[model samples]
Every structure is written in structure tokens, then in C-alpha cells.
Target: MKIYETAGFPNPARIRMALAEKNASDAVTFVPVDVMAGEHRSEAFRAKNPDATVPYLELADGTCIAQCTAITEYIDGSFDGPSLTGRSPFARAHISMMNLRAENGLLNAVADYFHHATPGLGPDLETDQCAEWGEKRKAVATKTMSYLDGVLAESPYVAGDAFSVADITVFAGLAFADFAKVDIAEELTHLHAWRARVAERPSVAN
Candidate 1:
């Protein structure tokens, strides 16, 4: 299998982290896709992923998988280490719910604030509307963070005591949030501790 992604330190890092957890990184080839040079926007890249996104996976036979969620799910199901999603139906549903909530509620908002607002990334350099939208989206992100903090306080992981795929999804998103300078409240003690734990994991650090 081959994974095509940008060289820099965002979503690709998350995928790498996941692969490390599964002991699959050594098994797959890494293909660096340049985003800064608009290589992903090129016709060749689009042929692999119409969305022109990074962290795309190509199977050995030549099947391309787009989106982080889909790729992660595939890896989780295919590998035989620890099950990240879950072993039960209830666990799967709960993990999926938490993952979706984090992606839509927190991750997207953080991206709206950072990628859209920041000037370094193409479209952000062209206008102030992105900045304006970023500022507005920040409020929603704050609310989502607070909610997740509370959830983390009650449960060891995002879904429950067991570390699941939802934990990876949320962790990756929050890591992105950290890069964007979106601060989680100091009052979120549980979340702060949980973040520390996740960071300490070999997979995450790898």
C-alpha cells in the first residue's frame, strides 16, 4: 500500500500516528504530495482524489481512498493489533458518534479559524472575509471544546474508558487546534491531562 500526502505537519502527521499505532507505517510506502506548490490541485492529483486533499491512500492494486476518516477506518479494520474502533456494535456506534461530533463541532471550526483566516495558505491571502469568518467561527469552537472537556472529565476516552478510534479522531483535531493557537480553557483540567496522556503515547509522538 502507498499513502500520498504533503510533507508538512498536519493531517499527514495524524495518519502517520495512526499507522505507527497499527505498526503499519513500515509496511506502506509514503508518497509526498506538495500542497504549497499546488501539486494536489493539479490534474494528476485530482485524478486520485477529486477533492484535492492530502493523506490519500492507494492500495496495492491501485484503489485510492480519500478522507482521513475513511483511510483510518480501513487501516483499523485491516490490521490486527489493538482494535481502535471497537469490538462491539455499541462501541462502534458510540465511537463513530464521538468522532463525528469532534470533526464537525470542533475540527471544522478550528480549520475555519486557522486555514481560512491565516494568510500563508492561498485563499486566505486574498481576502479579509476569511478572517472575519474565522473570528466568528471561534465562538463555536470554544463551545465544542468545553463540551468535550466535560465529556473527557467523565470518561477516560472520548467514547468511554477504552481508547477507541474516536479518541484518535478527536486527538488529531485538537492537535490541529493547538497548532492554530486555539487555546483550550485552563479550567479544562481533565482534557489537559488527557491531552498529555495522548501525547505521551508512542504512536502520537512517532
Candidate 2:
């Protein structure tokens, strides 16, 4: 398998963390895609993923999988390591629910603020921005941080007592917030503590 990604980017980092957690890092070859250079928009690259997004996974037979969640699911399911999504039916459903919540409320909101409000990537890439909407989304992301803090206060991880993909989503969201200059309030102590613990994991630390 060949994984195309821009190293250090938040979405790509999520997939990378999943790969590391699954202990399947060696199962695929990492191909660096230069998003800053607009390589993703090229026809050749677009043929693989019409969405023109990075952190794409291509199977040995040429099947391409886009989106971080889908790629993470593939990694966790196909590998022979401890599952990152969940082992049981209830666990899987809960993890998926929390993962979607983190993605919609935090990760996507921060991304909107970055691409619409700020000079994300550059003027060439960030056209048709809406600062007003971006500001609203920024506020949404901030509120989500508080909500997540409360969630962490009740559980060891984002989904439940065990580490899962939902935690990965929240971790990536927080990292993206830093890049976008969005601050997590100091009052969100539980969230901060959760982040500190997650950071200690080998998958996240590396």
C-alpha cells in the first residue's frame, strides 16, 4: 500500500497516529504530497482522489481511500494489532458517535476558521473565504472545547475508559487549533489533562 500525505499536517497526523497505534507503519509506503505547491489539484493526483485531499491511502491493487476517518478505519480493521475503533458492538457505536462529534464540533470548526478567516496555505489556495462565518465557527470550536473537557472529566478517553479513534480526532483537532491560533481556554483543565495524557502515548509523541 502507498499512503500519500503532507507530513505534519493535522489530518495526515491523525492517520499517522492511527498507523502507529496499529503497529502497521511498515505495511505501507509513505509518499509525500506537496499540498502547498498545489500538487493535490493536479490531474494525475486528482485521478486518485477527486476531492484533492491528502492522507490518501492506495491499496496494492490501486484502490484509493480518502478522508482520515475512512483511512483510520481501514488501518484498524485490516491490521493485526489492538483495535483503535473498538472491539465490541456497543463500544464501536459509542466510539463512532464521539468521533463524529469531535469531527463536526471541533476539528471541522477549527479548519473552517483556518481556511476562511485566516490566510490558510496562501491566497491561491484559500479563495472565496467568509470571515464572518469563520468567526462563528471559531466560537463553536471554543465551546466544543469546554464540552469535551466535561466529557473527559467523566471518562479516561473521549469515547469511554479506553483509548479510541475519538480521542485521536480530538487530539488532531487540538493540534489544528494551535496551528490556526485558536486557544483552548485555561478553564478547560480536564481537556488539558486529557491532552497531556494522550501526548504521552508513543503514537502521539512521535
Candidate 3:
């Protein structure tokens, strides 16, 4: 397998952390995608992935998979390790629910704020922006942080007992929030503590 990605980006970091958790960081090749150069939007790249998104997975059979959720699902199933998406139907559904929340409420929200409100990727790449909508999304991101903090107050991980992809998504979401300069309220102690613990994990540390 090969992962076409832009290094240090949030979505790519999710795949990297997932591989590290499975102890398969070196199993696949990492192909760099120069997103800033608009390489991902080229006709050649679009032929393989219509979405033209970074951090896509390419199987040896020439099958290309886009979207972080789909790629993470493949990673969780292919590698031998604790499941990132739970095995049982209920467990998987629960994890998926929480994962979507983290992605939509936090990560995507932060991204909206960054690209719209802030001068993201500069004027060349960011052709369109709505500062008002971006500010609205920033509010959503903060609200989601508080919601997750409340969740962490009762649960050890984002979804439940064991660490799952929900936790990973939240970790990456928080990292993105930091880059976007979205202030996480100091009162969110549970969230802060949970993030600290997650940062110390072997997979994330790697």
C-alpha cells in the first residue's frame, strides 16, 4: 500500500498515528503530495482520486481510496492490532458516531475557520472565503470542545473504555484547533487532561 499525503497536515497525521498504533509505520510507502503547489488538483491526480484530497491510500491492486474515514477503516482492518473501529456491530456503530462528531464538530469546524476567517494557504490557493461563516464555524469548534470535555469527564476515552479512532480523531482535531488559533477554554480540564494523556501514548508520540 502507498499513502499519498502532505506531511504535517491534520488528515495525514491521523493516518500516520493509526499506522503507528498498529506497529506498521514502515509497512507502506509514503508518497508526498505537494498540496500547496495544487498538485492534488491536477488532471493526472484527479484521474485516480476525483476528490483530489491528500492522505489517500493506494492499494497494490491500483485501487485508490479517498477520505480519512475510509482510509482509517482499511488501516484498522488490514493491520494486526487492537481495533480502531470496533469489531462488534454496536461497538463499531458507537465508535463511528463519536468519530463523526469529532470530525464534523471539531476538525472540520476548525478547518472552516482557518480557511475562511484566516489567511489560509494564502490568497493563491484560497480563492474563496467567507469571514462571517468562518467565525460561525469557530464558535462551533469551541462548543464541540466543551461538549467533548464533558464527555471526557465521565469516560476515559472519547467513545468509551478503550482508545479507538474517535480518540485519534479528537487528538488530531485538537491539534488542528491549535494551528487555527481556536482558543480552548481553560475550564475544559477534562479535555486538557485527556489530551495530555493521549499525547504521551506511544502511537501519538511516534
Candidate 4:
């Protein structure tokens, strides 16, 4: 398998964490895609992913998988390791719900703020930015911190007691937040503690 991704990007980081958790990081070849240089938009790269996104995975037989969620699902299911998506029906549903919440509420919000409000990647890549909308999304991201903190206050993990893809989503989101300068409110004690715990995991710490 060939993994096309750029280091330090939030979505890519999520995939990396999943790979580490699955102990499959050494099984694939890592191909760096330079998003900042607009390499992902090139014809060669677009042929693999028309959406022109990184963190794409190409299976040995030539199947390409895009989107962090889909790629994570594929990785968790294909590899012979602990399942990050969950094993049972109820567990799967719960993890998916929390994962979506983290992705939509926190990750997407921070991404919008970065691409629309700030000079993300570069001007050439972010020509259609909307500062107004970005501001709104930034606020939404901030609001999500509180919601996640509340969730963490009740459970050890985002979905429940077990670490799942939802926790990975939130972890990556928080990492992106650091780059975007989106401060988590100091009052979000539970959230901070949860972050600390997740950071200590080998998958994230490295």
C-alpha cells in the first residue's frame, strides 16, 4: 500500500494515528504530497483523488481511498489489529456519532477558519476565501470545545470508555487548533486533561 500524505496536516495526522494504533505504519510506503506547493492539484495527483486532498491511500491492487473517515475505516478493517472504529453494532454507532461531531463541529470549523479567515497554504490555493464565514466557523469551533469538554467530563473517551476513531478526530482537531491559534478556554479542564491523556499515547506522542 502507498500512503500519500503531508506531514503535520490535521487529516493526515489522524490517518497516521490510526496507522500507529493498528501497528501497520511499517507496512506501507509513505509518499509525501506537497499541498502547500499545489502538488495535490496536479493532473497526476488529481487522477488519484479528484477532490485534490492529501492523506489518500492507494491499495496494492490500485484502489484509491480518500477522506480521513473512509481511509481510517479501511485501515481499521483491513489490518489485523485492534479495531479503532469499534467491533459491535452499538459501539460502532456511538463511535460514528461522536466522530462525526468532532469532525464537523471542531475539525471542519478550524479548517474553515484557517483557509477562509487566515492565509492558509497560500493565496493561490485560497483564492475564494470568505473572512466573514470563517469568523463564524471559528466561533463554532470554540463552542465545540465546551461541548467536547462536557462529553469528556462524563466519559474517559469521546465515544465512551474505550479509545476510538472519535478520540482520534478530536485529537487531530486539537493539534490543528494549536496551529490556527484557536485557544481552548482554560475553564475546559476536562478537555485539557483528556488531551493530556491522549497525548501520552504512543500513537499521538510520536
Provide the overall lDDT of each model, using Cα atoms, as 2-decimal numbers. 0.81, 0.93, 0.95, 0.93
Model 3, 1-206: lDDT tens per residue?
Answer: 99999999999999999999888999999999999999999999999899988889999999999999999999999999899999999999999999999999999999999999999989878877999999999999999999999999999999999999999999999999999899999999999999999999999875
TM-score to true structure, per model: 0.92, 0.98, 0.99, 0.98
Better of 1 and 2 by lDDT: 2
Higher-TM-score candidate among 1 and 3? 3
lDDT of 4: 0.93
Q: Between prediction 2 and prediction 3, which has the larger TM-score?
A: 3
Give the candidate order by descending lDDT. Answer: 3, 4, 2, 1
TM-score, model 3 to reference:
0.99
Candidate 2 residue 60 Cα shift, in angstroms, is 0.3
Whole-model alpha-carbon lDDT for candidate 2: 0.93
As a TM-score, model 2 comes out at 0.98
Encode model 2's per-residue lDDT on 1-206: one tens digit a residue: 89999998989989989999988888889999989889999999999999999989999889999998899999999998778889999999999999999999999999999999998889989989999999999999999999999999999999988899999999999999998999999999999999999999999777
Model 4, 1-206: lDDT tens digits are 99999988999899999999999999889999988889999999999999899889999889899999999999999898778999999999999999999999999999999999999878889988999999999999999999999999999999999999999999999989999999999999999999999999999777
Tens-digit lDDT track of model 1 for 39-114: 8888998998999888899998889999887888898888879877778899888888998888777877887888
Once superposed on the true structure, which residue ranges of model 1 sit more than 4 Å away at CA?
A: 120-129
- Name the regions of candidate 2 deviating beyond 4 angstroms: none
For candidate 3, give the lDDT: 0.95
